[model samples]
Target chain A: MATELPSNIKSSDVLTDQTSSKWLPPGLALQKVDERIMTLNVGPQHPGSGHMRLIVQIDGDYIVACDPDPGYVHRGEEKMAEYRNYITNIPHLERPVIHDSCNVLYPYVLGVEELLGIEVPERAKYVRVIASELNRCIYIMYWLAIYGIFLGHSTMFMWPAGDRELLIDLMEKMTGARVTHAHFVPGGVRNDLPPNFEEVCLRQVAYFEKRIKEYAAVFYDNPILIARTQDTGVLSRQDAIRLGTTGSVLRASGVDYDLRQKEPYDVYEELDIHSNVMKEGDSYARSKIPWLDMMESCNIIRQALQKMPKSGSVRVKLKPNPKGKGLNTVYKRVESGRGSLGCYIVSDGKPEPYRVKLSVPSFRNLIALPYLLKGEKLGNMPSVYWSLNYWPVEADR
Target chain B: MIGTATGIIRALNSGIKHLAIKRFTLRYPEEKLKFVGDGYQFDPSTGVGIAGLKGRHLLFHDHCTGCQLCSIACEGVAEAIAMVKVPEEHKQNKKAIMPQIDYGKCVFCGLCVDACPFYALYMTNDYELSSFSKEGLIYTPAQLQVKPYVAQDSEIIITSRGATHG
Candidate 1:
């Protein structure tokens, strides 16, 4: 992902030859000697764009290029790791995608295990897969709920969130924390699923299936959406790979590259990963990608549950020492809701990691905006952006 | 060509049916929407009425710690929250405290309610709170404490604020 340029690039570099020099202008004409059109700064605080800011270069009504303004939501996560203990970093990493905390941080914990050469028990791996996939569902549902808000579809926002309450309740019972599940330490998960976990999960799955169909009936097959999204913001296969994209964004462009299926992490190798690929590469494809992935996530959780392995310990139960674990660094990438959520830890083999960098999918998908927006109309910009499912907290981190 | 015609005709039929389904919009004020049981639970604390329901400032002044954390969480352009200290010598263990909310400045993001640690706030469903004076708008801790006698949120006290949340 790091091809060129420094680790730190100044904000002044975001401005291009196309900043309008005016806020209200609609279009710009091009000529050999013409000045670049004006650029608009939309949020660290603005509607449509959530949490982080966007630096958009507009040539008249169309966007010439759009660059993400990261750091408002940075939270100094990498910097914070320098001082915090390994256990302490769990809380901080959880904050990045709090809803998918287990998925984002579980791999980091597993990496620490790899360095220490500690084997996570069988029962714990089964439970971790369930929790992580369920976390993916939680985040994808949240994206759908919020995307409905972006599309001005109020009922869509309310329906998914209301049903999501059941899943949240189930997760809350197991982990204690409603949103942040700081379970899954170096050796294993916090504990086994409580009684009636299977029954409740089955019910939620059934409820989700019905809701998924409803979501499809409302948006998937909706006429107004077809006109707005079909063939809009199309990206070819080559550009997608060259740009370092993954998950649904990569799969939507016919890459067939899923870490769960290809890399075979966890129980995913034993189970068949069902993926629905589309080569259209349009905004509609991007919008529909989450729906496909959500169902796939459900399938993964179901398999992880069915093939429950016999167990040992949940945690490796390390002896505490002020001296720490010592220096060892490991980088682990896991498929998460937004994209490839990679966690890199440089441990001094101490109690705390020397440095931690989270490579979130939102951060990469965010850069894909300018390429998509170049020739699209201003009125259609919101629709294109919503289709991208950009979350500020994940991107900024 | 024949298949495309059937698809268009079916599309038109569904479109008309959808419009008919949505045409049954309730007048809302005259005939309200209903919520099922446990009915509603109105703690003397949390003044927040239900999302679309009607009720005015339900507050808990006795338990308030006056941390001003609510002001920090309010997502708005204005700083509706202000703090004034009672001073050290004035008394109960010489403590210093201040948490004053200016409604004129309050955008009502309910962050204060969430931030209060002690759940001392709520945005009751009272939608009819139109103020003629700027003074009427700035509700102090005292004014925000009690609910109206008539409940002021619904018709005939049949579906009063307390009944829904009780």
Candidate 2:
């Protein structure tokens, strides 16, 4: 779907008045001096804001206008990708979403494999699917943990953080390293499953599922959290579609669109993936969608584990410094923890790509922030903002 | 009012029930978490790496051919592995050079290990690479040859009460 910014609110420059003093910020000045509109910067350093600034203009606790200032953590990831070959780009590209590195690297690996003309084995495909689902759960847990602390729920923070260790332990045994597991490669994964990994994964995942179900009592069903987030920052189904929101945010608004269900990259078609949707479009719905997705992820992982081939090669033997076939462009996207993470590569028959572009979901979902925040009370900002499942580092990258 | 009260009570009950559960935190130094294997190793013949903890780099002087493939691989990624000329004379190693890794820059992605066709390099489960000085962080080929002793036994034991590092 093609989406464009409403011309009325194209830029912060349009919001400024000619009568404003040079020293004042863009959104501060108004035509009428007595309007009592005050501008508040949530932060590049504020507790609620994560590495990005929000320029919020408010009047008597009601927000008049909001602007999200991202790019504090931008490291020119795309530009750096052009310098490195396809294989070396694995470690660097996965940095944006360290928590879901496998999912982030999934599209890049898929795209590279297409360009280099390498066939991934059936076992590798199954392993990739399992790893991806596991990573999705890990990411959603982290997000849920943060969503808890953001809503002044301490127990919510501790439980998910602790419960997440089960999967992280599994990931370490599978890929190595806790957060930035550069496990996914072009031809296939960097390695195969460890000895006796299936039994351990199944045992831990079953336990992990039970643990998360307990969260309903403590975090999700809590009256205080429900009161704070429900009916606050409601995004309509039409608005969600118009804004081109992806992942949980889109699903929260009654759009039954998930890249896994719709696109079915890799072995997703073989596995039974349930795309959860909520009709309500509030902060509560947005927050609840990821938890539901985590449940679905657990199911997907179980099915993938069952379907995987017992014994086969997980990686293809590629020629050293493998170059692209010819001057060609390939775009591949997969449903990541945040949203649909797309990788676009332009290769000119070189080991190093001519261009690499990552269409990150965080950046796309960010467009809804100003739309959702406007006309809402200032106090509900953290709940609404954090509920979007926006990761600042990925957006900035 | 009843719904709200029940919700609050339910949350409180969940919190109280967790008090009996064993502590999840592991006391580091005193108690180190054990890894599954020695380290991450790659088989050049199979073109696949064995899954293990990616920690510090280990060097085998006997296996190193001084081909500089590992160094060349690391150049695009981290430039952590440097081919340094060593004084030791070996029959296989003509130039007496091996990968001297600066752990400070190493992301521990294990690409260099993957690049080593002769199996000269592999990652070990010795991640405690903290040093006071910057010079100490760089492991020479000789320093990498000595395998560090790891005393780790703790594993995550999930029980009915709750999971804990035991």
Best by TM-score: 2
| Strongest candidate by DockQ | 2
Query: Which residue pairs clash in candidate 2?
Result: none
Tens digits of per-residue lDDT for model 2 on A1-397?
Answer: 1122345545555544445434465444333433488878888774432488989989999999899988888889999999999889989999988889999999999999999989999999999998898999999999888888888888888888888989999999999888899998888888999999999999999989999998999988999989999999999999999998989999999999999989998888988888999999999999999999898999998998999999999999998898998899999999998789999999999899999999999888989999999899999998899889898989888
> Tens-digit lDDT track for model 1 on A1-397?
1123233555366443444433322223222322567677876674433476667767888887676666776677678767765544555667777777888786688677776677766777777788887777888778788777777767667666755655665565455445766666666664456555676576566556555665665666666666777888887899889887677777777788777777766666888788768898778888788888888777777777678864344445443322235677788888877777788888776766778888888778766777888888766777777677677776766
Residue-wise C-alpha lDDT for candidate 2, range B73-147, written one tens digit per residue: 999989988889999899998888888999999999999989989988898999999999999999999999999
What stretches of model 1 exceed 4 Å from their correct place? A1-38, A46-50, A310-312, A321-326, B1-166
The superposed Cα distance between candidate 2 and the true structure at residue A388, in angstroms, equals 0.7
Candidate 1 lDDT at B3 equals 50
**Cα lDDT, all candidates:** 0.62, 0.89
Clashes (candidate 1): 30
